[model samples]
Target: MNGAVVEARNLTKRYRDVLALDDVSIRLSADRIYGLLGRNGAGKTTLMSVLTAQAFATSGDALVFGEEAYENDRVLSRVCFIRESQKYPDDFTAFHAFKAARLLFRNWDQAFAERLIGDFGLPVKRRIKKLSRGQLSAVGVIIGLASRAELTFFDEPYLGLDAVARQLFYDRLLEDFTDSPRTVVLSSHLIDEVANLLDHVIVIDQGRILIDAESDALRGSAATVVGPAPKVNEFVTGMKVLHREALGPLASVTVDETLSAAQRTGAARLGLEVAPVSLQQLVIRKTLINHPSRRVPGGDAELDSMEATR
Candidate 1:
């Protein structure tokens, strides 16, 4: 509590020939929400695994509350990791699973869990194996929110949930976060969907840190300028252009720098439209243009097309 809630130093993990994580280092504080973002197989899961002690780091250190995380009950008991494919015993029902979670998590809030169950309309008596994928996701979401651990990680906990259910999860998360602040890390492919909720954004590509900055700073980090083709081209000549679109006499160019005050005024005078880049668009442009191969840390195949789009 006096220092970083979680810290990783040169954390590395290898699976045979593949390096799932490679010399990754990060420090996370308590009472903040962190967005753990990356395309599929970008080592997001592997990183989380090592941090939570679910898996060991190949050649680095992971400390939770200043102590090694692996098999450390003091740290593990205060952390809750809700995975997308969380499994419950075949004979257990949703209620039974909730009961088990309540017992495991020292900070579990029974009333909050009950309310989440009601909000998600989860069937308490239905066997875990009988629930649909979305329903199963709802169970994970419920536990993640109700656990109220000092540090909680939600790794795509709403994978099969519909838009409405997903929205509900976001709403509940935001509301609860405001009321009871804690360290929360959300790992998801729905970048745009959760962009607004994130206070900090961490982008990983090919097992490397691409960008880690305040959400607002990232939003204004770049801007797109649109104007007549020749004018736009000339204006962006010396700047780092992330993307471009041209149509006859019109062209739009996205650059990796904020325009200076004079430059902004000049663009306005020249009848050019300037707009801040969205987090999703910025991330897409960076991953696609900067690292086209999109390999993970160790030579994993590129993330699928759908993941790239996210």
Candidate 2:
């Protein structure tokens, strides 16, 4: 964990029969935004919880700032963990939450917090229990941005935010991050929304790391080949086919390989259309392809189920 802001070595978390994190190891460098993405119960929350010391790993190490995070004031003070269902005292208001955060996080910016409150139209005087779902999420977003912690973990920080509010969060996050870079680990089910904000991505599935690579590298790492069934199948013969759909004689096959310029020209010559796979599409295909039980017998009924949950 020498130069890493956060690192986990063979981390495992098991609750009797359920294994949340299965021998997971990862290294997160400093001053970069990372997307910790997965489906509904894919150990994203468990990983963050262990890293922040909110929950202990059943085995192995969880380090932050080059030291074990549990009960380490020097490490914990520079870290902020804003969970989806963050709780506050019944009597506490948004103002009180900010006050507490300011005292907890040494780099807290009160002025920025005030500006965010106004931007979100949050009712600072309203009690935490009295605020609407969207307002509650806004409170968390404000604290996460204004805290300015060196290591921040935002676990579904846009839980109740609408499309507009979510966009505002992304805009502010990128703007502030450009001015003052920090290590940010964002775990969200909305992969497409936060895809552009991430420098690196670590996708988890069934308590294991499915894909961990730079975001730029992953963008065009896969391609879809479409043409007559025979030629399309031949084009993707040696490639790792992620998915395949057939409509009469036409076959569109998604392959997990970066095609060369010559390959693209060859496909065109063979009357095949090559299209770049989107980040969202790639993630879904990889996840579903790796787990066939989640798919319906002949269609994507379970894929639809997964998307609905997201």
Candidate 3:
């Protein structure tokens, strides 16, 4: 079995009235790409902050490399956290940021960073504050990849990037990760885009752990069924249903169990449509089931609230 590179036990955080993190325990196996997913205010950022020592835990423990992470220079230097709004000095340019990272990170690769700068077309001479949002994000992505830290956390790093730019980031990260294997935890709202890159998936909802399992196992855990309401209902029995929607007589429902061979045969015989639930669909349906009344009119989180979650 793989050893835990990151571990937390009964971790909780409170910010005034907001209970940011509930009593949550989780572990990330070393040298793997893990997806940290959740809705806004799901404590995803809070959990990362506690693990990275940027914030304190109200209770329980957070350990990195079998040691407490807070104020621990040895552990801190080996970790890199690049969020959407990572701070840089007013005088700092993209090159300056890379230089700072090279000095701080023990495993920094200057050549890799330089190549990424070219790939992203980042203005090395331009001040960090002057770069566009996507360009600024590219700077962070370059650092996160080239730093080659033992543990890296990227919390929604592509805030204003277009599809082409986002795909470039994904491509470069995937390629670099294969060459330099390390533990990475990426948090993103574009679940489908990064789903393929994840070896493990951990979902947090309402300050609590909702789903934590191997990505392969999670993909096979649930399925969606679309057909007539009566037939879909009759075909799905002895299975936990996660969510359901009705369009006239036609119905669409997601079930919380893999389709057995017999179940698949039955569904096919009954002229029902049985499809595998995607990682994004599974997460969305689960979140909806968890909060029945709170509906997201659109899938975009930025549209709902421009304010950043603390």
Q: Each candidate: what lDDT?
A: 0.86, 0.90, 0.88
For residues 1-310, write the lDDT of model 1, one tens digit per residue.
Answer: 5369988899888999998887888888878889998899988988888889999888989889889877778888899999879877879999999999998899999999999999999999999999999999999999999999989999998788999999999999999999989999999888989999998888877777777888888978899999997777667766766777877789888888878999889888888989989899999888876574544453312332222232
Per-residue lDDT of 31-133 in model 3, one digit per residue for the tens?
8999999999999999999999999999999889889988888998889999769999999999899989999999999999989889888889999999999
TM-score of each: 0.92, 0.93, 0.92
Worst window of 10 by summed lDDT in candidate 2: 301-310
* Candidate 2 lDDT by residue in tens digits, 1-310: 2268987899999988999999999999999999999998999999999999999999989778889888999999999999999999999999999999999999999999999999999999989999999999999999999999999999999978999999999999999999989989999889899999999999999899999999999988999999998898877766767788889999888888899999999999999999999888999998987685755565554544343232
By lDDT, the candidates rank as: 2, 3, 1
**Inter-residue clash pairs, candidate 1:** none
The per-prediction CA RMSD against the true structure, in angstroms, equals 5.4, 5.2, 6.8
Candidate 3, after superposition: displacement of residue 188 in Å? 0.6
Best by TM-score: 2
TM-score of 2: 0.93
Between the candidate structures 1 and 3, which one is better when assessed by TM-score?
Answer: 3
Q: Which ranges of candidate 1 are over 4 A from the true structure?
A: 292-310
Among all windows of 10 consecutive residues in model 3, the one with the lowest summed lDDT is 301-310
User: Runs in model 3 with CA error above 4 Å?
Assistant: 292-310
